[model samples]
Target: MMHPRLLATSIAVVIWGCGSAEAQTLVLGGRAGLTSATQWLNQPYFGYQRVHGTTAGVAATLELGPYFAVQAEGLYVEKGARYYTSYQMRMSYLEGPLLARLSWPIASSRYRLFALGGMAPSVELRCAGYQTVNNPVVNFFDAPPGTSPLDCDSQRQRHTDRSQVMGGGLAFDRGPSQVTLEFRRTRGSDIAGYDC
Candidate 1:
């Protein structure tokens, strides 16, 4: 697999090239967002838990034309499973998306739309994947009489694979500023993690 720093660099360079000529025309901004996933993705978990959580991050977008742009974001998420012995995991990631956007004004009502697909390489910093075991580093939500602790070995590793990113949103523009509501999903591996 590629190094995390290298992956991020490649994304930046490629995006820069895609809109280099119109770099000045790009709209520079930041994003505040969150993420959630199903429990199936958290297999081999320490225990039976909800496995749903929120991830927050920021992104910057580069627009080459009215219909073409590139965006990059970095995020951190905390998640856990609620079983006999609950376990928690923390993930950090950086993502890049090649976006196709459209914008036009209808009288005084302005609108903007964009769709994106890209790669996201992530790093697993802290994870308590073995809470079911007798000696767990983290606490639990609910456990059976003797579950011998949940399988938490997977949480003690790091993966940086190219993850999949896809999503879009609508925005209202007024002059140089706009307000947008967007949603996206970063599909990671079921066992390989969000990166690998």
Candidate 2:
């Protein structure tokens, strides 16, 4: 659950932006994209690899001027990493990003270039892992006496994560509609047991 103060602050920002008369334009749109996510682990024994996922969301932008805007989004994002040879972990979250955007038009206002920097707060919806081991083990300390190494799956409950996001993109304007191509990087918070 989100803290009440955080929720109130978010609401205040939105209300202030919309209430300002200097906000000359409002753009509302939806976006979908692919994400390559991986964990940054400090453990020497664990080598994490990127895992591909999907992200989709709706965005709202309040233009403060010709070159400045405040944008916010509500998105569903999938993030995780792979370790060892056949072990994988996955986490899904509902994320919200608040960004400051700067844009300028070029080539007779048909093309626009923009850059954005933001912070995203995400709440975990699900977490799971997949592990596969071929060698059978019977060590009581780590497993039951007769326990055998086999494919296994498990789920975990985790807390919310806050990430730093920054990116740049290009947009093409056609009358009232615009198309954008953006590239962004999201650096997630470190887990308690994970070093760095």
Candidate 3:
């Protein structure tokens, strides 16, 4: 969740009073965000807590008009879904998306109300550091977070992989500041296989 204060600031920039045309010609700025994302899983199978983390990164934008622009953003993301009885996992990936942005001006308002949709060729890396765990019971189940010292070590997975991403989001802008809420999905053979 973005803090209320920071949100207010972004909105102020998105709604900056009308600026000189040259000042509007090109916009170079950055953005940071938070997200609640998790693996697609069955709650009945894993009673443990879901994957919870934030994605904060940088972005660059080129405004083509009041209604259209091109955006390129790179975010280090943490994403996963949960399933099975012992679903304990943490993973992270660096994703770069090049997308087309569509925007609209609010009626008689300084802020621009916009919807963004685009395609991103991306990469999903497998974070590493999962250890060979000891199975105490004759009936072997996966490792749990509390089973042993394996709990003390964890790292983001890194590997060679890529995918296609699609997402749509809304943003409010004034001038140099903006607040955006968007959802994007990425899929590749990597998302399906254990090696990815």
Candidate 4:
């Protein structure tokens, strides 16, 4: 029931001069960023609001040539939605993303610009802000007063997600190491048997 929107900034190190005379072919890095999340619900009375979260991860890249490369990352992210001003639906996941990149050097400068697109598959690690109520016969537009708000995890059997990633970045080349700043957007696809 949650579709996430994410913006990330990261820095990576280009590993070079490892007893090779060729250009750098491998990079390793770590990143941490903030996330804003929201969800869509079937109930018309409930209006979802954005909740804040965090993302952290490690990444690796393999250069295929001067202008093309492949990258992979392992990330842990927090996502959810806020409703009713006090109720929050929170979830955490471990994600793996594979991306294809295209890069080119800026004219007469030590900077490179790159664009990337990929897919990330995630497994839910934790979920909260939901409870079962057997009393009063809960239904749409009806709920027991003072009950915990409903979350996607309580309404669905699927605890996994596949998200799409797209972004661009600028890198500063400094000898054997490079520093990169990137902005990315991720959108989650609907999971089977999941509803809110």
Candidate 5:
């Protein structure tokens, strides 16, 4: 007869050993890319244009199998929008994304095509606004009665944002390194102000 506690412990150890043999591989990487961002403002009356910026980050990928993986990234991103000719706003953020990726190789080649979908949560670090004064005298004083000056007054922007990310790109895989190009769209809740 065997002790129940000893039998249970042995069984647990065997299961743990088996699970360890099939553990996912963790790969660490870094990425740098350009981004075009625009604020989805509630006020549609204000025409917003895309603002170009840069994104750089470190990423960790957990390879679950030949076709499936999960990736997480920590990045610094700049986002904002330009309204009309004189007013523009830029905001900086620290962003993190958790993404699920599906990949397939091309006929046993070193190149792979992958698609990723994810959610990114970001914290705003700073926000700034700029305006080009075409005519100082005209802007300083409303010389002509209905014409308004350049509204460069800063507003209190929200400190946090969350966005849904989706995109696909190609990757070239080397021994321990890979080069990838991806285009992703990020849409989300309003960053500031109430809906109009």
Candidate 6:
């Protein structure tokens, strides 16, 4: 597997090249936003709540034409769930998303309505916070109870994840650059280690 850093650099280089000619435009920017993240647990044990966190990233977009574009981003995301207000789990990740986007001008104005959907591959950087232990049935490891402590272990969790990304938003043209307000959701596709 390619290293995450190398993969990010590769994406940037490709985006730069794609934007250099043929009436293409390159838009580079930073992103800072709020995230309400949660995990889906298959077991009927714990009730999960959305955990609030911050998301920040850098994005490179290559506009192929007036209506279509390709975007690549490198982000640090905090994702996890809160368990009954007593415990909050936070898992940090390095994520790379490559998306295909479509945009349309709103009545020939500077405002545009856009929608984007794509796949994002991510690596878990760390896991923190608390794990609630009630009856203590099967732990995250799926081992016999008591064999594994109820603690945050990054290694025990899956290191890599494949996710689906879907979002839509409005964009305002600003000369050579654009300002956008977007709403996006990313969902994990594979079961985490032993649990979903």
Best prediction by lDDT: 6
| TM-scores, one per candidate | 0.59, 0.75, 0.59, 0.72, 0.74, 0.76
Candidate 1: lDDT of 136?
Answer: 38
Q: Write the per-residue lDDT of candidate 6 for residues 106-171, one digit (tens) a residue.
A: 997999999998889999887766544666666575334434343665424567888889999998
Query: Which stretches of model 1 miss by more than 4 angstroms?
Result: 1-24, 39-50, 79-108, 129-151, 155-158, 190-196
Tens digits of per-residue lDDT for model 4 on 93-175?
A: 99998887778889979898999988999999987664444453544543435455576655456789888999999988788
Per-residue alpha-carbon lDDT of candidate 2 for residues 32-96, written as tens digits (9 for 90 to 100)? 99999987667687668988899999999777766667889999998887765566667788999
Alpha-carbon lDDT, every model: 0.53, 0.75, 0.55, 0.74, 0.74, 0.78
Model 3 off-target regions past 4 Å?
Answer: 1-24, 36-50, 124-134, 137-166, 185-190, 194-196
| Candidate 3 residue lDDT tens string, 1-196 | 4689977964564455334465454555555665455433244543434556667667887775576666788877776544343334555777676765667777867666555544454455544222334564332344554342233123223343355566666676656576667776655433433333
| lDDT of candidate 5 over 1-196, digit per residue (tens) | 5589967965564344332427566789898999898766566677578899999989998766556677899999988887665666778889999887778889989988998887899988877665655454444452333334333234434688888899999878788777788888887556566441
Over 4 Å off in model 2, which ranges? Answer: 1-23, 134-157
lDDT score, residue 102, model 3? 62
Which runs in model 4 stand beyond 4 Å of their true positions? 1-21, 41-47, 130-152, 192-196
Instruction: Assess candidate 4 and give its TM-score to the true structure.
Output: 0.72
lDDT of 3: 0.55
Per-model tally of clashing residue pairs:
15, 0, 19, 0, 0, 0
The candidate 1 region of ten consecutive residues with least summed lDDT is 38-47
> What TM-score does candidate 2 reach?
0.75
Full-model lDDT, candidate 2: 0.75
